[model samples]
Target: MDKKFAGKKLLVLGSNVGATDIVQYARDNGAYTIVADYYPADRSPAKRIADEQLLVSTADKDALEAFIRERHIDGILAGISEFNLLIAEELSARIGLPFYFTRKQWDMIEKKSDFRALCEKHGVPCPKTYVTGKEIPEDVMQQIRYPVMIKPVDASSSKGVFKCENEDDLRRYYPESLKESECGEIIVEQFVTGDEFTAHYTIANGKVTLASVDNRYPIAMQEGDPTTIPIARIYPCIYLDAYIEQVDAQMRALCAGIGLQNAILFVQGLYDEKTNTFNVFEAGLRSAGEAPYRFIKRVNGINAMHVLVDHALLGKTDFDSDKEDPYMKGKCCGIVSFVTKGGVVGSIEGLEEATAALPDVIEYECRYPVGSETPCGRTLRQLMIRFVMICDNREKMAEDIAYLNSHITILNDRGEDMVFKMKPERIWGIQ
Candidate 1:
């Protein structure tokens, strides 16, 4: 087999969920991969898969940069972590490497306040946000409606975010939100009660394309939890055509205004079915941690890992960028993430059986093994195992998911079924 990247050495920062795939993708293409983080090899799975493991913290900029120089790293890829993107862009610029975004471009989209401003500038619909970096004014507070969201301007994985049902709720969560941010900033925005949706986009040679959109079905959240991240996401976002007609052009304008080129991003938002509106809350500037790229590749044959690797290896893009099928090309795809309650995983079951039985399950991974402690699996942090599949329709997806759900279980020391709290059958149209 010919090795396209035989001579190249790629540096992947942060052992995020997506980093494993990025490392594997690069290594498969004949490049040496380095996984950098401060975690033990057991904690960060990507470290075990890489050609080399650098036990240096990605946040230690000085030491990390020195290692890059010493290793003669050819490229650095920060696929999904919000904090790691800043580090990647900085180190890439300092070392005269090819980065998708400059400091200005990174600032424009990474921060919630700035991205909201950019959306408003280009006529894209985002939540109506109040002041950032501090609490809302007393006078403004009186005029505001109930049910708002307070979150840090620069944080990911839904950390330090709160869904405030009233003024008291906002006041209580404001300081906590601020504490989560490295920049000591917070944004209070209107909280929409509707189905959450995520629209994925890929930019190439200055042209933007809406690759796919999916509806995020949230796990039933416990009280005091931040807005629930999804337990499962089904593609062909029933509102796909509506999105193209209403918000796609404005989004393209927003990306063009910021001069973003050659990258993948997904806008996280809620769609009000009653009002027929799509409102955004977050914009991730790389492959989503949910691993939407897996579905995109399985459905349409465009590998996002390949696209990102091409960009990181210095401006060379070998794949076609203009092709996109946001409607999923007449196919149905689903990503089911099994989440458990807070505790040490005393046992795990049916993993091997499900993988063997379910032919449609393209990929699945469980990060928290037996005996591993998971702190509040409500957030994306504690996702036990994620299964991605593509099939013909929602009915088939429902059957497969129901079967898989019945098979897999993550129990704590209490001998309870941890992941059965919100069965996928609820939204997937199965009894």
Candidate 2:
């Protein structure tokens, strides 16, 4: 409508919740948006916002490239999902679109073991990692100390990730990790017991800049079939002032060492209390999974989505025009997503009242309609609803969260209320 990208056609690879926002951004910014994914049009929220939807598999590189050429598309973008990165790389090469990563760089970051090795090669602090093939060797097995994390080398959102306390646990979970990866590879990393955090970085002209950091809250079900899943992200993190300098230094080294100096990177690491250092566990050359674009903008008054679109579309390197600081100064914000044990929802209650009563609540999003069946899983896909809250201080943030827990209720088909709790101690990384 504005003609910012009036004649431009932007192709997005996926049509999930995150991609929906990307599609809308393009449309709102005056670009003709096209979304390509195998998901049926009716089920794709992004397809509703896009000008066109190509019901082709994003993995079908040849077909997608042909579509791009035939349609005269101008640029390409993909969100947090890793599976679509290869497709983006392929289409970018075939059509000369602006992709943030080269295939080599993409491979290095997408494969967990490769990134760990890169960390070691560059002297970046990282958890001790051991790569395993189809069979775990006795020698390698002998070296693994207790309490290691077993996960796929090429998966996202902690899918197929397990914390093994002993050799027996490793043997039982190794195959499960392998199944989650397209590549038959898995890694056993010595678990660093500490607070977990994720830092966002932007690279331009070979210089790395820190965007923001958030305290990641990972939730786990301890009673039945224990499993860990990330549930919330709190911003204006408590450790920002204490650790920003060192974390920035380490990220600069990582970006320079990996030869990645023209895109955004989401770095996940742990603040190891034992070593008193931050050790990276994973890095991705893309956005993080938890709708960070919205969070960053809300808390810091910076539009990450605009910067990303401009960077990917026009290759514009300067992003400081909209930067603001002191960023999130004297403020606190949190994103809390809801989930169920997996069942057909009979009814939902208190959403409207709770949201209206909380003055600090800024945004509310629900993924499911009433009566829809919700899946039972530990992945982000199971997230049913999300609430964005902000306050003058952390005390108020905690108070708002507690109110929601006691007020909001989700009843399954059997009319049983699903218990929702936000235990601070269970939060993955909060030192």
Candidate 1's residue-wise lDDT over 131-247, tens digit each?
776556788778778788888998875778888888888888888899999888898888786677888888887788888888777755576654566678888887788888889
* TM-score, per-candidate, Cα-based: 0.87, 0.86
Off by over 4 Å in 1: 1-6, 28-30, 38-49, 133-143, 157-176, 221-227, 344-346, 374-377, 409-414, 421-424, 428-431
lDDT at 156, model 2: 70
Q: Which ranges of candidate 2 are over 4 A from the true structure?
A: 1-6, 38-45, 130-142, 157-181, 224-226, 321-327, 423-431
List clash counts for every candidate, in order.
0, 2
Instruction: Estimate, for each residue in 1-431, the C-alpha lDDT of model 2 and write its tens digit.
Output: 35566778888898754687778877887889898989878888888779998899888888988888998888888766767766787788878887778998877876888888888877668888765555678899998888899988888756789999999999899888889988888888888776778887777656676777888776664555455565778886667775665666766787877776467787888786666788888888877776565756766666555655665677665556345432466777777777666778888899899999998888888777678878776666667788887778777877788788877888887999753456544333452
| Model 2 pairs in collision | 195-429, 196-429
User: What's model 1's lDDT at 244?
Assistant: 87
- Give the best candidate by TM-score: 1
